[model samples]
Target: MNLNLRNAVISNVSGNTQAQLEDTIVDAIQSGEEKMLPGLGVLFEVIWQNADRKDKQEMLETLENGLKK
Candidate 1:
């Protein structure tokens, strides 16, 4: 069977509110499970695709700072 993980992940959270989305992300991070990575990657892909140059730059900078910790 072929599974489109990105589509599946996006569909699962399609209409979630901001607080709900935050809870989903926070819960996944707190769980620290490998299975959650794909979903997070899908979410990040959506963010990256929609981000403006300035937003992308800020994200990269924030990610760089996060890596320094």
Candidate 2:
């Protein structure tokens, strides 16, 4: 449930395969059971931390722009 554990699990999932990631996400989402989505924020934080500065800036800008809509 912790971010570190979630990242570790995700990291062990091998390559950055989008399909596999999507499937995992779908499985997590479709559980139809009550559970915390705590890992999402941690995942975002990890992604932000690992992103290039320019990409991080662009992502923030995009998020800001999206919020205005």
Candidate 3:
């Protein structure tokens, strides 16, 4: 069985509108299921790749703050 999770996740959400994407993310997070982590990670990767330097720094800072608690 050869499965590419990243590609699969991307393809699943490829044509989603912004509102649909937001709903997917919120639903995933609220589900609190381990299986959703990889999908969230792929989404974060997409966001990180497209973010500017300041945005990346802010994201890192936010992650750092989140881990501190």
Candidate 4:
């Protein structure tokens, strides 16, 4: 079977409101389950794709800081 994770993830969350998305993200994180990683990665990919250069740099800096901890 040919599975497209990105498309699947996007379709799953497509119609969610801001609050819904926030709840989903928070719940996934608080669960701390490995199964949620792919969805989070897909969400981050969407964020990265839509971000401006400044925002991307800020994200990178945040990632760097996180890695330091």
Alpha-carbon local distance difference test for all models: 0.92, 0.70, 0.93, 0.92
Tell me which residue pairs clash in candidate 1. Answer: none
lDDT by residue (tens digit), candidate 3, 1-69: 114888888899999999999999999999999999999998998899999999999999999999999
Q: How many backbone overlaps does candidate 3 show?
A: 0
Q: Evaluate residue 27 in candidate 1 and report its C-alpha lDDT on the 0 to 100 scale.
A: 96
Please, what is the TM-score per model?
0.93, 0.56, 0.88, 0.90
What is candidate 1's CA lDDT for residue 33?
A: 100
Best-to-worst lDDT order: 3, 4, 1, 2
| Best candidate (score: TM-score) | 1
Candidate 4 per-residue C-alpha lDDT over 1-69 given as tens digits, one digit per residue, 9 for 90 to 100: 114888898899999999999998999999999989998999998999999999999999999999999
Per-residue alpha-carbon lDDT of model 1 for 8-66, expressed as tens digits? Answer: 88899999999999999999999999989888988999999999999999999999999
The backbone clash count of each candidate, in order, is: 0, 0, 0, 0
| RMSD (CA, Å), each prediction | 1.6, 3.6, 1.9, 1.6
Could you tell which candidate, 2 or 3, scores higher by TM-score?
Answer: 3
Give the runs in model 3 whose Cα sits over 4 Å from its true position. Answer: 1-3
